[model samples]
Target chain A: MAEDTNSKEYWRWTESNWRDPDIDWKAGEIISVGIDVGSVSSQAVILVDGKLYAYSNMRTGSDSPKSAENAMDWALEGTGMTQDDIHYVVGTGYGRVNVPFAKRAITEIACHARGANFMYGPTIKTVLDMGGQDCKAIRVDQKGKVVAFLMNDKCAAGTGRGMEVFANLLGIHITEVGEMSLRVEEEPPMVSSTCVVFAKSEASGLLREGWPKEKVLAAYCLAMAHRVVDLLERLGVEEDFAITGGIGKNVGVVSRIEKELGIKALKPTLDTQIAGALGGALFARALEQKGRKSK
Target chain B: MKANYGYKDGSGEFFITLDTDRCTACGDCVEACPYGVLEVVDDPVDPLSDVQVAVVTEAERKKIKYTCGPCKPVVDRPPLPCMTACPEDVIAHSW
Candidate 1:
């Protein structure tokens, strides 16, 4: 079984699931769900009374609704809970409206801000969510309300999809890019082109010229870091910085960003990719509270 | 220089185009936008041009129809606040 699974897999990052094993869902008064269907990945998060309960992250399929449902189902599995148990559902990310079960659709900007605020605490004022197809630099208030934000969906250069292409080209697993690139003794010059197509061709040329794979990866990661920092600077960065999305797990880029901005990112104990869905779940809880009070 | 906002997905395409040449980069559209969708950025589409122009924020680009849904026209309503605020008359929406 293990050999078969390994043989079938491509250069894909491992999908992940996490649950607060100690949390008793039966005792929780509120159960809310947040599903974020991104272009490259989908995440489903379950919250019990404003606390993280469970979450699942998987590659997004072509059909966003199917991806959303599958992610939620994976998260719900073995939890002894079903869709009926969820009191409020907030769908977010690229396919927010496509979430059939979501009671409301929230923008990833607001959701990421709320998630960063919760994960990094009230001091978090800046959130950089680098997702599959876009990068967002959001400034939020102490309570996780959006102050000002900017997003870059116009190009794939600085997004996860770009990184995925590079990973595939380099024949490296997506998860290994960060650590592997760090192994380079000296940082390489950044690839000039921000367009993925041009960058891919540039990488091929570098490989043919005998540049090591690690150096090429470093160059791309540096370019990505610089590009995202430009986005953050455009919106204006503040202290108490934090990053979310799949790229947040990649220290190669994150460290470079921290160095560029001169502010250490507020690290999250849990997986950073779940931040959006987690924020959505938290919003659902807030809505749940309002509903209860109004009733 | 035309910059299109929004993306093509399995469902369909939603785009909001801004002709930068007509825009004066005045803060009118930015201030008039209640949803905070428009911002003035150094024109990225035309690198040779240093002129800053109002364009849809990146996050709102791919989802403007949904993001700006609240202000969408209903039965011959007046122009949108952003469009109305634009002195240059450069904004157009593809619904």
Candidate 2:
């Protein structure tokens, strides 16, 4: 491959979508919103009468409330729907409690399962949500209620941040890491370090020993895939399995995980990263209906 | 609304106390806890009652400071999952 000079443009994925142009929000009676403020990214989703209307995914800033507001604003940019136009709002993820306008806050684990149920259909029994700084393996019943779950956020070894470090070192865009790593003709030896700090130094040492960047990336991705597999096994893998969060977009990790488990994950037609926020929106809709029934 | 148990060490403070008066032993915390830090056992802290109650697991009793280390939120983050899952308004962490 020829060396590319555009260093600035390649670090992030371009697959993010702001809104679904097909939906006409004016025709719907109820407009519910869900905002997920995660450690690395934030998402805002709008549901019009139980159908997805608009959504936005962006990097989370320092302030949780501000991140929530910015994401929601971006999703509503061209929709002409202000905050007050939405009937109810549900907040989720690590910063859920800090969402200023939310009526209630739900855990990311619950929201991810619910969103996977909607996005992947009700058959999804297991969900692996690989977020920026943490990972969660969740088991959900047919109704999408969380039956069992496990989370690992203390370490960056199997998380998105770990991948970002490799991207930065290789000077390739984070979006390109997956494809570039997959381009290697042969699978390289796995990096032995499980800690992010140690792994970075390990990658540097490999490069010094004349290993190509692609091979190094392949090693790191392989280590990540193995680490996540252990977490999934602890919770017990049940089918139909689906993966959520930004890492779901990486074929390098997803395909390896499937190969190791001998079970393919259910593919989502919509963006997998929005699962948490989408689930929160669905919860908002349900809450509105429940309130009406009680009244 | 909250109960605390444990002690402070050179590394940090570690405590996992349950309010026996408010605990109903619903097992929600046990289900939500990912670290196996909690379990349903006979009420040893509260002798007045015969009901089963949630307590720190024997394995975690001496090592809670290390076991809960991974999920320990910074001062800014939300409450822990197990504490948040409890409907009876009990369960807390000190760190």
Candidate 3:
């Protein structure tokens, strides 16, 4: 992190701003793969030279490692690339070591910090990685270096799986419930229970109460969003707070949080869920560049 | 009866090797580790043995028990559970 200058120009042209100058890898320039095997979903992000050309997000399935492999295959398939062109492979998230073929494994925190730094600039000091099993608050420096972090690893109360659970009960696709939430006409039933099991019971009671699907969806969204907001507050969440992981795509959740916190959260155009994979890809480039400079 | 069953390696480390590839990530190992150093990661369908992947199990002793005789024995290959009941399917060597 001390490797950078503390000047205004330095901040403008920060490490976060550095992209592989040769955006297009020469036909055979080595490609690096970052496979994030999360609990609820997995993704594969590939960087050829410096430009990100391929990313795929899929249900993580039942296994972290195999799911990571499947996600990688999907991404490679999308870009008309194959395993052979992948010069190096990295595995992160809960399944970092599960990619039997990966050359190295890294922590999810490191990957998210790097990715957020790249997309939002070095000034991004905080991140909310709301994956399947956990929600984490990460603080980083200008170099995309992690400074402090906290995670809610033991609970699924505010994660993708939490929503998936109720979505299953409602017989609705988890993807569509976000949009359905916007149609809510009333305050919806209040969900005060923090335990998912308790929440499930509460939802069951609401169902019996004849709460319409619209209001029920609204309640679910609020309960879930509140849990996330609580976690963010714990990490001393600051300006330029970015949201990543698969749940980041839920505009209902995103808008609610933005309104609740009175601060806008930043998101890049790529699949927000694949941010961890993208961060893993960006770190690979940094490692290679540093290796070159040392020689 | 506590007894020495095998030799240590170049690293002077001894462990009962389980064929992780052949072994399903059923999380039985997590329940069995007497030292409590294992936890099943979420989405256990295909478990990676390595990430926040693993942590020191907190049990009576927080460290991994290396030479709990009658249990794990080093070998040219790996070992399976004996007749001892671990309650957690953790390895045991009492015979």
Interface RMSD of every candidate? 12.8, 12.5, 18.8
Per-residue lDDT, model 3, residue A35, is 84
Question: Which regions in candidate 3 have their CA more than 4 angstroms from the true location?
Answer: A1-24, A27-30, A78-80, A291-295, B1-95
Calculate DockQ per candidate and list them. Answer: 0.07, 0.06, 0.02
lDDT, candidate 2, equals 0.80
Model 2 lDDT per residue over A51-95, tens place: 999998887889999999988888888898899899999999989
True contacts kept of each: 0.04, 0.00, 0.00
The single-chain TM-score for chain B of candidate 3 is 0.32
Q: By lDDT, highest first, what's the ranking? A: 1, 2, 3
Q: lDDT per residue, candidate 3, A1-295, as tens digits?
A: 1233433221111111123344445474658778888876778888887567677777666877678777877776635567876767777888788987677676787788887887788778888888877776777778776665555555567777777777777877666677888787665655777777888888888889998776777887887777677656644778888888656767667777777788899856556677777777776665656556699
lDDT of 1 by residue, B1-95 (tens): 44555643323345676776688888798899889999998764322235787878866776676788888866676678988888888887766
**Model 1, which residues run further than 4 Å from truth?**
A1-11, B1-95
Candidate 1 residue-wise lDDT, A1-295, digit = tens: 0122562243456788888889999899999988999988889999998888899999889999999999998999889999998999999998999999998787787688888888899998888988888887778889887666666676677788889899989887777888888889888899888778989999999999999989999999999898888767655889889888888989889988998888899878888888889888988888887789999
